[model samples]
Target: MSVSFRLGILGAVGVLAAGLAHAGWLWFAWVAPAGALDPGSAAASSWMPLLVQGSWTFVLAAAVGWQLQRSGQPLQQSLALLRQQVQALEQGRFVVVEDPPAAEALPLARSLNAAVRRLQSAIEEAPGQGAQALRRTARRDAATGLDSRFTFIARLTERLADRGGAQTALLALRLLPVQPGLAPDPRALAAAAEMLHLFSRRVPGAFVGRLCESDLALCLPAHDLVAESAHSLIAALGSGPERLHCVVGCADHLGGVSLGGALAQLDLATAEAEAAGVGALVCRTSHREEATPQEEGALRRQIVEALRANAMELAAFPVVDAQGDLLHLECPMRLRLSPGQPLAPAQAWLPVAMRYRLTTQIELAGIEMALAASARDGLSRCVHVAAESLSAAGFVSAVRSRLQATPQAAALLWIEIAEVSLERLPPRLRNAGTVWQRCGARVGIEHAGAALLSLVRLSELELDYVKVASDFVRGVAEHAVQRERVQGLVAFVHEMGARVIAEGVDEQADLDALWALGFDGATGRLAGRQGTAEALVAPGSDAAACRDQAMSPA
Candidate 1:
């Protein structure tokens, strides 16, 4: 039954056969002839030869058995090693056999190692293809490839109920029917939608949706881009003489209201725009405070005043590991637009800052704050850099000069770029990432996984880590499909030599799920405090709130 037992039986049979052959030879060569002359002499001669043959057989059998056992050891060890590697592969771990136990196993090992390399390559290079698959499975409006009305409403409702009391701006566009009862031309409608899609892509955290056959809506959180974006759309449409009649309206949502109420107020603004004529834009506050050019001019003045007074505020929220050990503090920028007003986060004033070409200045100010805090507190601090600042002529050099000045603080700083920026401007991001890394600060991308194709580009940059977008992290706890996607993302990022962190992880279930999925770190409501702005800008407080809101359904 056993190999050893079978071998022993065959060895014993071979030895007995050898002895019989020797006895026969002795009988025929001497005993047979002698038997005719003297029978007793022949028998005695055969017995002597047989005894010699038996002795040799025993020696040969022992030597052969010992040799077989000695030769099998390497093979046994090789088989065990192969089994372990296979088990690791089954567990979603890519591994290779670096050294074969026996010379004969070399070919098998090489083959397995090649397979592992291929798998790693596929994961590292196939993000775009994978994202296409995700898009196919996700719900989207066919014409515009944006969120459907129902989907948009659901996400908007969620943002409205956010415990963080996030501030949002809701913008709606209406394409009027040509005749009283006739619908707009399909070609014209499609063109307008395409234009809106392009606009949405430019805004870092803007959500656009096809609200109906004749209406499209956009949501901007902690964003003041409603008026600017609406005017841009109207102007873009007006460029063509044959453009359709369009009206745009936006309203600020400071929370504590129903979706219906927000929509009603938005409707009022749209009606006002429609009355102004084709290609008109209007803005209203939740309480019907009109946003006029005078207010706009006043905001510009306030921005200048704040910057002159050095009113940039930085708040640090902790990013932690599974053991609750601090990894780094995520610092979101805030500013005091008016002397007496509570500080406002980037989302509220960034559009105005960018309009005035002050984004680079604000970003540099935030970096300085983060560096100072890191040095003072002896804790690593992170600051996000806007895409606009990266392209600003002297932004990088300015930061570089500052980092060079305070080597210790630079060592403790982490700079992050939005994932969208990386996708659109890989070369620029790479250049910035390289500069920052050389200056001793870590560089990475946040709000990642929005563009899976960007993963391939990550190899082009010197990234230390990437933060998974909150959209992917929000409901991973109970959704198997989402968990699978997250798992794949983790593996790809790990293979590319960058750690993965989860963003917007505000729930315990999501946190536990992320840990199980192998996230390096996480930051959100549950991971640590919401920092100073959220604490100071209480939901109902009269503080000037700047809320950042963007919702992309996965």
Candidate 2:
């Protein structure tokens, strides 16, 4: 029987027992009176005893009810404690609640204790197999098993947390054809996971995780050999006709910090990799000298004020044709804290801005600046789009609207999306290329050649231009093989109906070599010195005046 029902029966029994005792007392009282006195007196005494006995029975029933009511309090308390413990567990905390010894509460207490034990066991076991499972889950592009995005973030996080004397490095392995033909089959993801698991086991003290659907992160904890490690890891993926590329970023002496801080640093390092255009990009987060509290505080304050006042500036570097005619301008956003202070690159403020969820505002402002510049007669503009902004449906729509409203300048505006960012685009915004194109705006992929695996597939996307990475063009004149390779790339792009622009052209020889290589345009330190907006607006006039003054006999 249920506990309540049993209690009810016990209470009823108690009442019955009291009633019986009361009846016995009445019988004794009545019998004694009858034997010792007259019939009338005995009858009256018997009636009085019966009345007293009935009153006692009522008192016993009340006592039983009171006892039952008091017992309910402990049950309520036990339930409340159970709820609190469950809440704690849900929040990823382990909790042990001591249950009362009452018989009614023992079952619930035992159940809770059992659950806590199981959870603790799971926690203890996670480092071994659990970590493996998480790696498998995140390793493959949810669709293709190439690599998932989460795997990258996790591996980078762990690497950043490592403090062993050995050097730590992060390698981002992105599969070519970042977007596989269709939704990746689960079977494919499983296969990819197995392959990666096997691959990871070969590397000692290495942890692999997913950073996104298409990015896999590999962390090597005890290696001073970043370059060798990257080459080995890539080689293990096997020699194939198709390129299997890995972008690596490494740091030595990465110390302990909050997870958020580590992620922030990882994001910066990744950006550096993308910008650097290496087959593998490696960065050391630990500097020879640490930033003092005062310095960090000042930087933080300056960034805050810049964000608050929307005072950041966007600067444009011209991408000129072989004959030195401006084909378009590569507009990289720069931030200036105050007059006379040097401007900082987007990487400097971008991470914190993202942490603060201010990417959209910053991107929008950049778009405005680019459009304004393009609207000036005889100028074309290419501006970068952050992956996060592109992932948002609303932001895409807003950008489309803005482009449409500026149709006269839209064709001149080339929206450049990085390969990494492109991989993260949601389905709703996957057709962003089509959307932007329909609005009379052109699109291009920046940091090209870095992710050679994705190059051919992305090429098939039919972008308007491809900005060959600066690193690839660093010393094109000095290396025959590099020059021929660049020439071949320019030819291939031209055949695809897309223009090729070489970035990071810092030397006169690099610019001259690019011209001979059939590159349609070039942009970098060597193209021309960067100047203020007003100076750029009158490039011809400004240069003529300077030349005239310099040539004047002195």
Candidate 3:
């Protein structure tokens, strides 16, 4: 294969041929034109034969040169083609060589194509084999081996976009934590995660997402969602009404929705199932419901008018410690459309406010209401500000001005923003925190579960505490998985210099569990009843009785 060796073999063969030609010419006396000695000549005239021999030799040499040039054209062409194929391989393309390689390279081309096919197949089969595809992170959930929430959602969005208005079914399975108030065995959580994961693999192209700590969503074509698959999933995830179990809610969409609306539908369906009871499964086959543009505009108009007219009403709820001591009153301000109109709760209109980017005004209104009330009664308050508000132009300056106007309220105010909102624009959040500090007010993140996965990231924010989402705290006393997750979170957050406030601790058992687990404080109706803090809350003390009513539909 070496060039030197090839040249040596050719040289040896050339020498042998030349020696044989000389021997035959001399032995037969081929110097004469007749190719034999002339019997009648004393000394042969070598010149006469030399002329004839030279002419013939010239013709033979010319013919050989033409033959070699023709042969080399094929070699050059094949080599160029081989180089092109190699470059394509280097670039990670597995294209079939449309023009077969020359006979010499054909075997190599075949072998390379075979290797590429094998790698391509491996990439499709193993998520970790993404090197061929050059995708980062293996496009999966590291813990459960399911699709990560972002990946699942993105893939689902692509499918919906491709087949718009197509019938699609989504399963939102909210797993209730079991063996509450104890550290969950990681093996147990893994088993459950894998159970759902395997179920998702029943049909090819199944899309699954880890929506939150306890929520997993599976999206597939409507036709693939049959009773048999449902039964198998329930069996694997633990099906029973009397025991703690994961309840699945199914929502069917009719090509009439975007990804957001479809997800919202699943949420509503899940809520329906939760209300129904254990072993409950709710299915909705309705067309996706969406607010008309006109309706949305009208809602925005109402919120704007209310903000302009100072029509915000405070609904005070108590956040208490384990000792039933109220740390502070969370005054979630609500909006009223016109004079005498009942106030709309945060849930009812916050979504609308967020949608229209009206959160800046809403946050300002909440702070102003809380400040006014605190100044009037000397009560410490925790007021909510929308995360979107921080992005508003001049929002930090506005907060500073509000605080400066009632500097005394600063000491009594705690501004709460949803963790989901705080997650974006770290610089902006840091700036807001700086403003809060300058104003002598405190800020904390609320609804921590949806936006955060680990506690270490909390150090990035300038927050005093994080309110673990109510879903994590609601049944902590009986849910082992929830307890372990919250426990780790609390420990990590403490190390990060922030307290862990468990939200929605209405049950005595839940409260007791959270306290034992080192939760700094908590909030809910139960906490409110036992609160010892002497803070003056809403204008009417009867707001305590309206805790349930305040949260109800307007």
Candidate 4:
């Protein structure tokens, strides 16, 4: 029943009970015990007094009944108004409806307002949720069900930023027309589809995308597929049902460089593969890349000439100690394109040296340059010695002979070997490391995470330190997984009597996180050069500002 009806019923019952009580009092006082009292007595037979008192009781009850009806009007009007507003709210109207006129209904209005506000907030956030879904949808290419090229590049950049010495490689593949024809090949679509399917299936989180009609690229995470393994997998596609003829170009994000360099390496490798012939996978592993053996020889001749003439610039990045003092300068060789072409750096040429077994020569040359620079500046300097160079015959004898011949210069030198190359440490390199230690040149490993093998035998090797790979320290500040991994590595290295240095510290925040995680030293774009520790600010000291202004968005 309605609230007004229920209230009306209650009020009517109270009035009826009052009227019955009044009638009962009149009967008891005037009519009861009439026979025992004197007939002429004023109290027993006086009708006028009883009549007056009865009349007053009836008048007072009538007055009270009228007052009750007047008071119930306001309550009835409020309840009716509230009912309409509630119905309106239920029909999806977000407007704040007027409250009941009665002040007592304020509590109900306030509760309804609170509920409406909660729903409104949910409605407000709904678009942002939709935008996030839209963004995810846009990242994928419709044809291959793979990431779009833009998305792929974005992810690669993030991976590069986070590559704490971890390996990441890109595969650029072009589907060649199997049948020699002017029109479209019947096998073209099938071949591209088959290629993408195999790649996505093999690499767990592979980001594969088509750049154009038949130009496709796949980015393989280090944890999944290194460049060599990726090369092998694509080679497997050659024997598949599609029976496709293709050229694959593989480029690895080996070290610090611009995004363009990583992509250009893919282009060079693809060009080289195309020139090699059908079903070939060629990679540009060094600074100098060429399409043919003759062209490679020409580039190699230029490199040799430059190395002999010393036509190269030394770009030294400082590695800082825990105290924010300069520990050593990591001198990377920047060789010219054609002795004076200026643009190409050693990164572009080192792969050529590696390919042709000329790393020993390059290493010897780089060391001489580093030691000269170190002696001239009176600061300790370190140079990378390629793993291939370490494996070369008589490499130890040459290095030892040079060190012995110039002990003063060697004392201020440090040598670094790629950790990936140390998976099978040569006896000669180990012996050479001991000799270098005797000569006061500290030997260490760069990119030291042993993803392929255990570091349980690291103690057996002669090493002064092992740098945590660039990937581990790339986003260490915000990545819990990386932070925990680096923490364990630092402890393990310390236990093994080797110091831990974090590489790829591209931001002040990452640097701060590495320092907090117990690393002995840090180096990257953020780590300042000699005599300047100004940029190694603590995490809370406007770290976000430093991140925003200094580094590109990852």
Query: What does the lDDT read for residue 54 in candidate 4?
Result: 47
**Where does candidate 3 stray beyond 4 Å?**
1-170, 173-247, 250-280, 283-288, 426-429, 449-454, 460-462, 479-482, 533-554
Error of 4 at 240 (Å): 27
**lDDT of each prediction vs. the true structure?**
0.68, 0.56, 0.61, 0.60
Error of 1 at 350 (Å): 1.7
User: How does model 3 score by TM-score?
Assistant: 0.55
Residue range 1-554, candidate 4, lDDT tens digits: 54444554565555554444433433445643434345345443454454555455556555666677767877778777666655544333444556666678776666555544543443334322222232333356565666654456546655554424336677887777656533224466446655666766876766677644456787776522445764665666756765566778887643333243455567668878888887887765423223588877777887788777777766556678767787777766666757347734555565466557676776787788777776776778877775567777888778887777777889888887655455445544555588778877888877555231224334456578887656446656764534554565565566557888876566778877778877888776566532354443333423232211111111
Residue-level lDDT of model 2, residues 7-35, one tens digit each, is 55565556555544433433545543233
User: Which candidate gets the maximum TM-score versus the true structure?
Assistant: 3
- TM-score for all models, in order of appearance: 0.51, 0.46, 0.55, 0.49
For each of the candidates, give the backbone clash count. 5, 20, 7, 20
* Candidates sorted by TM-score, best first: 3, 1, 4, 2
Per-residue C-alpha lDDT of model 1 across residues 1-554, encoded as one tens digit per residue: 54444555676666665554444444555543333434354434565656565556656666677678778988888888877776655334556776777899877777666656644565546443343334433457776778865456646655654534467788888888878767767777787888877877887667888766677888887546678777877888888767777889888754533343455457668879989987788888653244577877787788888878998787656677877777787776777887688887654565456557777777788888888888886888888776667777878889999999999999999888766555445364457778878989999887676434345435546579988766556667865556656777787777667889987676789899899888999866666533332332234421111122121100
**In angstroms, how far off is 395's CA in candidate 3?**
0.3
User: Cα-based RMSD of the predictions, in order?
Assistant: 21.4, 19.7, 18.7, 27.2
Lowest lDDT block of 10, candidate 2: 545-554
